[model samples]
Target chain A: MPSVDNNASPPSTKKPLYEASTQFKNWRYSPDHLAHIRSTLNEAAVGVIRKTFEAYEPGSSSNVSFVTADEEHLLVTFYIHKIGQLCGHFRFPEEVEATAASYLKRFYLKNTVMDWHPKNVMLTALFLATKTTNNPISLDAYTSHIPNTIASDVLDLEFLVAQSLRFEFAVWHAHRALWGIWLDIQNLPNTPPDFAKTESAIYDSALTHVRAARLTDAEFIYTPSQIALACISLVAPDLANQWLESKENTPIPESRVDIPPRPSSTAISASLEAIRNMITNSGKVPHVEAVREVDKRLKLCKNPEKVVGTKAYLARKAEAEKKAEEKRNKKVEGQKANDRDPFGQELGEPAAKPGLVDYDDESDDE
Target chain B: MDAVERENSDRQKSWAKEQKVGEGTYAVVYRGREVSTGRRVAIKKIKVGQFKDGLDMSAIREVKYLRELKHQNVIELLDVFSSKTNLNLVLEFLDSDLEMIIKDRSLVFLPADIKSWMAMTFRGLEFCHRNFVLHRGFKMTCQVITPVLRWYRPPELLFGSRFYSSAVDIWSVGCIFAELMLRTPYLAGESDMDQLKTIFRALGTPTEQEWPGHTKLPDYVPVGQFPKTPLRDLFTAASADTLNLLSKCLLYEPRKRLSASEVCGCCSYGSPLYIIPISSPFRYPSHPSKLPKCSTQMAPRPLEEVDGNVDMAGTGPGVKAAAPSKVKLKRKLTSPADESRTRSIARKLDFTKQVNSP
Candidate 1:
């Protein structure tokens, strides 16, 4: 028999709720905050694009375009789903899919879809998530499914995506927590003999909801365990209630949650409330809108000369060419100088002159 | 500058580097202090120049795990920031490590002292395991020492198991416990083959009956018959219970090895020291009734009787109790050849460096 010696205190994955609160404060985003950030980014991008265009056509304001938060979020969600499909085609681990989705979500949090093309960003996020999670695929392998993409396209933006997330690549998934909870139920005393098949069915259904829950911003607002519990509660409220009752007296792991081991009933209820709110909030289908104009504006930003040769673009290009020419001229001059004097004369000490004061001799005389 | 760069610069300004304390393969460590709080910190500047990739894999793993891990024994990563070319991880400043203490002949380690260290190591490891983290590499360094001593690495790892679990760390802790008893590396081998030989020699050759899948390992090889050395023979001074626990930890089968929590539960068998359960809210058991009654001869001296200034935590500055003169004399007596041997152990794990004020 397995030794029960260390069974004095059973290990658990449930941390205190405070850790969840801190994680939320660190990485979570409220809808209002997302809206505020997205709008601000859109306004800034539009102002820059407009100013650049206006430099070429002094009186034209018609070319300036803006992406609404709704349209931008729709684009983001579309690409996130695209990332999931891409991972599925690649047959990467579930973590790759989760991470790619998370990367897309996090990237859009601080950035506007107009600033960087979502298609390129989405591909980069998938490529990076694949590499980070240890199922590293070559750039060729990564871009094989997507057309008109190359290694540099994804490789160049890797640092940008990583920097946006501040290199915090660790993402918790509800699947593991849900699996743990299911096992906990099976291990409990007097679990029905035939409960295994039903438990598997319940778990499968709960996992389906968890996937749907991910398409929402529940990850930002709630911990993985909370989301998992909420997913279970949605399908198997009786089992969840049973699980809650079992956990009522048993203390939660301090590592998982920073709160008291035996949390007050109010704290537990408040968590349940937050999880329910997340599930409901996620249930609503997002309104989709056209983002063609925004995409065009982004394309124009990449190559302003394509649509209109703005004075600023022309002048900047001319200045860059002039600098390059001057750099070439300097290189030619340096080579000529080197040919004339192999050991550069300026680097050698100045020739001693009779008229120059000998400071060392003077000091010796003193 | 971009927003990411701006944020990084702000984080950089918050911590003030006092001086360069140590340097290793992957990072240069600095003694630092938080600007506002004046709290001591060790800033490990990771060398990004080597990897064409943005950040080193080990740095990423360290940050990924250490950021979430919170325990007294585990080294805490306070903040992570990138400077012009290097990634700086602001870690809790730990002054010394087990290697230094073990090497210092001036200090004598009692059974109680070893027990305390084991308790703390297991406590930290138990949390890591429960959190689904496997400290694949655990070695003694200037920072918080881990269980994966080269001499202590488990047989599975040596056999090249890519998907090993927490059992690997238990083998390391067992090696450390034995090291404490022997005052030298128990199985310090020159090479992988030699190391395996030493392990087998000490614990007998594993057959299919003993380790069902031993032959299936990628690097596994058949060794000639060798009788197992009795634990009491190796650890002559250790109690019977201590020997029993050691055997469990060093079990050939990875599945049979006691887990970190299991090790914690068995603490009563080996030492009077209270093992702190990772998840339990209760403090260390204080009641004498809960304490196991062991032979008085084998029992450790009362905690008060041990040297108070020895720095048992291994997180504080080098022990002040060891007389400077004696330590110097001991160093002087050791041959230059012996000094060179000390450098043989590669300092691969560069997590934190203790900054000594000159």
Candidate 2:
């Protein structure tokens, strides 16, 4: 057989590692695609939530005002800030803080605030980010930071958030990319004598822009490097331009391994423009008054099944618990078999012959 | 089931779960085949313990790391789904690991076989390092897929170094490389202190000059000077080129240690090329499939009498590492694999020549 590399078409032969990341392939989108996905998810969520609302009280869904995709976006943005503040409160590193916000943002892209509110999802997203970024904290310690919160509040939503995000934990934040650019910029020839001071100021300001960019649709719409460039351009346009110019005409060695693609200047400029515009326009934290209004409206529009004590929530929980109880009972019954394998009971009946073993994962986990 | 539940169950049903392979502290390993393609897979079902925490950190870390890395040398995580009220991770099925192959007395270790395994490990480590992952995983994670094997912890951890990076993995690569040749763990430390002592004993005690800030580490303990045994002496039969890689990897200073890419020999401009160069004489076969596998059924069973005991120190998360039962295990490579390997090596050499010709 031909080598797998030989089998692969030329498109991905020497692409940089980030290009293969889930953040690049799965999370990235054009502005239109991002809008379309949000609206589609919102529309579906509204329709399903409307049924639940009406089912509880006839014509109640019509009486209740559901949040629009834009409004949901506003709520999610507000929670992203909460994640940032939570990270601050916990004194998490920048990566943890940014990763949590990114997780919350990505979760809502697939899920809706109506089905799983970003308020709860934000906690779990931050918690999961801590783990993925290798700065793990106990659930008790995490929840204790927030008043009236418990371990289950964060724990229950973890799998759901992980599921919603398709278990892609590695998110390449723009700040890291910007840091790379900062390092590379130093390595560039003919730097100003005080380039350190100048670059530090620019980097600090660009870091702010990059953090703001996280709240925008920039991550979904642009690659981290592109976004980093955009942030740098926002801070010191000349520096960003010089960096691009320095990188543009670098000789592609004969081997041509790991060359970051040099897109045409116009194409890169357009992408940078879109990214910068996003960072400037919608990236600020949503006004608290505006977010509060949306949050008040969200109370009426939420999927009652997710609420703790609502009839729908109780009914859903009872059904799930009943199914689980049945599963446990069946497991207990299976445990009665006189013979057993090392791990667990066999799904099939016990073997008649001695020294014969069977394989069944029927009741595996505790 | 709603969309999420339905989707989860559908994923769960896609693989037909078969025999139990190995069980871990937090998960169970089951050998299964994907129903769609009949492709064999190892299903690691992470036990959802009495719901104090939502998921285990090990499970999350394993899934997170595996999902990002996709290499033949690194174990592939095929799928992940929540089923039977627990998380099930579908992994590529590998029947055996280096520990088993090394331990089997009947199996002869060929130079090419050692090179093949070392090369695969280096490639996998390179990928991990490229992704900015510090492959410091030291859990009892079995198989070639786990870049951080339990037996291969670097010395820094013992000396209580917190801020280490890719260099740590290079040290492990060095240890693994050495182990491949010696057929024993190069720095087999029973405990944290013992491990450090073992490492110092083999490769002399580091002075402040050798490793700057040697005394400043949090857990640094004074061990009397032991002259560094020449690596070639310890690895007596090893070629100079192989010993060169070992020294580069086993450097005392973390900063001085060769990176994964350096060991893999990156020639791209501005990349680390401390040791590996384009024209380096020694190179391992790139393809791992052509490498030797433990047939597991040796004609002469040194381990047949021991029931279910292969003395496997650590098992991969899933997959059948050693022959589970007392069934005749492969301690010998079949004659065809032997033939294919030589053919593969020749083909690789020709391919290398073709590339270098330009």
Candidate 3:
């Protein structure tokens, strides 16, 4: 029986929903840890792809260049910008645009551009975002919008990209969180008399900053609410500070001792400032020249098995087909046996007990 | 049942051939056990690349929201993986839902059972509502079969009001609570108009004075005036406290409805529900595990995910909540690290496909 030991934790003083989010749980990392993961993944991919190139041609790897972690990051960033442009072309909402960008960035964290090209992955991620964000566009309509693209180019990598995302698609974007704060700012007690006049302009500017923040590591490092607060501060520092002060002065319920004390206004401001700086420092789109060089290297290093008309591709396809064929034959036999006694159990081993490996073993005999 | 015999039988045959346990429009549910822990799980295998568009909207919504949600009341999405071109969601396989139990003529629902179900469902709803998640409308959806959804819809939605809130879920809970008591749907509307007529007949047609801007709703039209039906007439056995809670949930103004916290009797607001004391027969809403195998089976099919949070229905305890045999998803992924060396003596024969030739 599933344990029911946590009954004491009453419904009162529930943790904010964002804290339980997969974004906070699985995706977060310290800056040092994030850098370490990327470097390690890049190095491992380089070593493995190097061997594959060598196997294809003697000493070919030495002649070719490998993409470094930084170069891969630069190239993925370039694609992230392209996603925004594509969204504009398609007239997709901000949620779709941001989600696609989020998917591409998250995908690269788990994978390298060399294994799967960013171009194909970006298109797949965007197409996926259209569905996930409820902005559905027909595949034909989507393919026609982009140049030199086919349906397969996007559809083929859909599974790979979805897996890389670990199927966590409800991204808490900074822009949405910013909208909440913008609403709260209107009702603040000490709102500037003339604040209403510039509210739209201020929000638009903050939205611009939030868009930039998407290109950086701010999402992994900070909460959406925190990022939004920072964006608000970037556009209207005094207004944000005043709002924080009002919150600090307000007393929390006496019964809720478990809830942490509000951060001092200064501390909140300092953290907000740090977040703004993080976005401002590293959030610019990578230069085209720098990205083009990386893209050139990516084409040469991309998995040969994934590309069309490659020997490795044909070999892998044939092997996969053979495995599928054998499994199908085994399934047919199992069905024939079942036909003899439709109401009875499996003619041989019960599938539940044998596991998939056992099924493979059974197929090996035939 | 006799008229669509062909269509119905065709569905049944296809369902039998397709899956051992369950099948939906976009996915099939297979029963599989995890080899490692021997843990029971339902493998919801979604067919990918089968449509002109890529992954199904329902599959994406399932992963997107369910992955973020982790509550005892909500079904657990154990894991997700892919094999070939299929997306698989590993979910806890439970046997039954509230709908089945309510519909089960053999089982009797005690007043305490009714309270427990009410409290549990409300708590699950409260968790969504407290997060400002407008369930059944936008951020999250409660997808059940049509009867459950239509029966649970609040008046505002029936009136075509686009805006929704915690009050929306409150109305659904009220309907579910009524079903638990009556063992029949409270207002089983045959159509949207009939649904409103049924509601007005039972609870009196709302006027501008009662609902405050009731006539201004997008779908609002001139509705007939009907006196409110007495609670005693509908729920002859329900206690006074039960009546109060039910009435609060069914209030005309969306804001006037009781929040999940209040209904569960855990609120700091001068407890309107204190009369239905926690120490009463409804003992802290017992965990589903404590009961028989009537646990929830969650197979999230795609519904709308955008701004208009239209709901499927009492999306609570009964949608396709059937306990499939335990089965866990196994992935066959292509890792980035696979190196094979084929030491060929020479390139003797060259064969190439000309499929891409133009």
Candidate 4:
């Protein structure tokens, strides 16, 4: 049987990592080097602290401060593992797990853990990921699949995640790229015969490395094809070198081996090192007390009044209510006129308000 | 309104929906125009919460692939925005589809026209396959054909092969090609079992030697031995080049079935549709003055008559039409045509109730 070139074009060609990463990064972090609207410890730290303090001002008390970027990362990383476990239990395709984690990671970058609890947001990401990956389960089955969950918990937060990500749902995972590289490597004339026998093991180990790479910020920094090549290099450097060298004057059609144009060997080494650094950096486990404190502060931040309970909170609530009331009254007034003046336009009335007329007809049902 | 709702509305306002064009099981399709440029688009508003699930799988699959696939032949997913819970998919608004053209009995299909449609279809499929995406429900879709007829479901699907690849779609394209020539479904089998029988009767019963590992399929069943009917006989009017292309696609072994790129390389489809003009001794009647009049009347006969002739092997097209026994038998029992007629009647009844309905 002819070897089908499993490698088509890497998904990164359609959407580069740099462009997609910037959208997510700018949303969470500040554009200026100095400050963020919300900050994390590494790059966006100050912004997160300021936002948390602004949202949850416990009467000038110093007790409920924002969590460090590391703590935030730890909490998110923990739940991402949970997402993987859940996906595993459900027998979801690997793409679902990858997308779910990507969404969760992107969500936390812009939002404080305090803003939206990871419990529901985590599950929502999975649900939405399943849909985006073309393996959607019924909201009922999805909720019931996990213990003590309901449909609303997942559905309600879907919009929030989507909006935060700017509704850019096309996510590229390294698994496919890795598979492509593996296929190209196997077909090479230089591959050892024993390599064919250990093919499954090598594939599994490479996949595990790819999965590990997902936890790092390398996804935002590098293209999927680069990350895939980097992972392959880590697992088997000799094969990776051979695969890279095989590119020159190769008889294989470029379309059949959908590898992105190879970066410089130095660039490849640098990316692999970055991936290694990320893995090493993420190895540190934060203190349990720190994580708990962050969780406590997050609850208060989600419902700020619970901690604030100040006149400022009441004043803000009252103002919102007043604005809503005024809007509702104006809507009713418009609907009454529409009902009374069916031929209002003929009578030379105002060309009905652009958004107002449609709103009334839809909601009022008359 | 909350910020999210406001944002969603802002996105929605960009597209001005003119009117609802059609409805699917899980979507309300609207013919819309972009507010800024007045570009015509099809807005498929996927109905939320139909499945106990959050969103339909078909919607997910469509969006997942459409976002990445860029081709003139394929329907483009221009934009996706949510209006409350419903996700509105702005798509390229195609004026007509191949199925609509084939179904319009009044519109005679020139070999050139059929070739053109096949080239476009195969080109699109080839692009999708090259990108490693599968059009799982190909010919069974409403966009391609009447949704209920599983006639184009490949033998792999019938044998309960969950791991089938792009070849499944290739098989379906073969059926579409045959339909283009026959002017009716090539195998309008009612059930999965019946579908296989129809396929085998038209082609031959697949032996283990012919389709290695076929017996290992989950639902594989041994059927009575049947000899292959020559493609020339079944597609009576097809040219040799067209017949050769059709057989390659309809091969029993999926791997033996032509890939989209390979199909494109065939003698018939190798060049542009009009490069070699097809000269025919028997010219089909030209398109009727108005298509609807002939379609409403002529379509029913060709449909039932095609099936009746297939079943009674010796009877020719003339005999099938003249035989009162076959007509009464067809009417007494439900045929696909009868089922469609019933559906049309139901559709008419629903017209009176369309007022104030979503």
Model 1 residue A263 lDDT score: 57
What pairs collide in candidate 2? Answer: B75-B145, B142-B315, B142-B316, B296-B329, B296-B330, B297-B329, B297-B330, B298-B329, B298-B330, B298-B331
The iRMS of the candidates, in order, is 15.1, 9.1, 13.3, 12.9
Cα lDDT tens digits for candidate 3, B64-134: 66677665555567777665556667765442345555555766766655555555566555555555444
Worst 10 residues of 1 chain A by lDDT: A356-365
Per the 3 Å backbone cut-off, how many clashing residue pairs does candidate 1 have?
7
- Candidate 2 regions exceeding 4 Å error are A1-13, A187-190, A198-200, A257-261, A321-363, B50-53, B137-153, B206-213, B228-236, B270-291, B297-358
Query: What are the clashing pairs of model 3?
Result: B32-B326, B32-B327, B32-B328, B33-B327, B58-B302, B136-B309, B137-B309, B138-B309, B148-B314, B149-B313
Give the per-residue lDDT digits (tens) of candidate 4, residues B137-254. 4442233223233687798878877566678778877887788788888988877788888899999999889899998998988766789978887677777766777888899899
Question: Which parts of model 3 are misplaced by more than 4 Å?
Answer: A1-13, A261-273, A333-366, B1-19, B137-145, B221-223, B265-358
Candidate 2 residue-wise lDDT, A27-110, digit = tens: 878778888988998899888888887787888888788899999999999889888888888999898999898888888877
Q: Against the true structure, candidate 2 has what lDDT?
A: 0.67
Query: Tens digit of lDDT per residue, candidate 4, span A1-366?
Result: 121222222333333333434333342322232123224323343344344455645444345455555556778877777788898899998988999988898877656564466777899899988777655567777777788888777877776787665566667677878988888888899787677577677778777778877776666666676778777777787887788778755654443333445457787677677766665565234456766777876654343432246554575678878986787888788768667756556655667654412321233121
How much of the true A–B contact set does each candidate keep?
Answer: 0.08, 0.26, 0.39, 0.17
Candidates ranked by TM-score: 2, 3, 4, 1
- The TM-scores, chain A only, for the candidates as listed are 0.71, 0.86, 0.86, 0.75
TM-score of each candidate structure, all chains considered together:
0.69, 0.81, 0.80, 0.71
lDDT of 3 by residue, A1-366 (tens): 111212323643466567778877888888898899889879888887777677778798887788899999889888899999998988898988999999998988888877778888999999998887766778898999799999999998787677677778778789989888887788887667666675689889999999999888889888888898899888888877777776677787776544666667677667687789988898899999998888887888876766678876787789879987888798778667656655766568564323232212222222
Q: Could you tell me the lDDT of residue A39 within candidate 4? A: 47
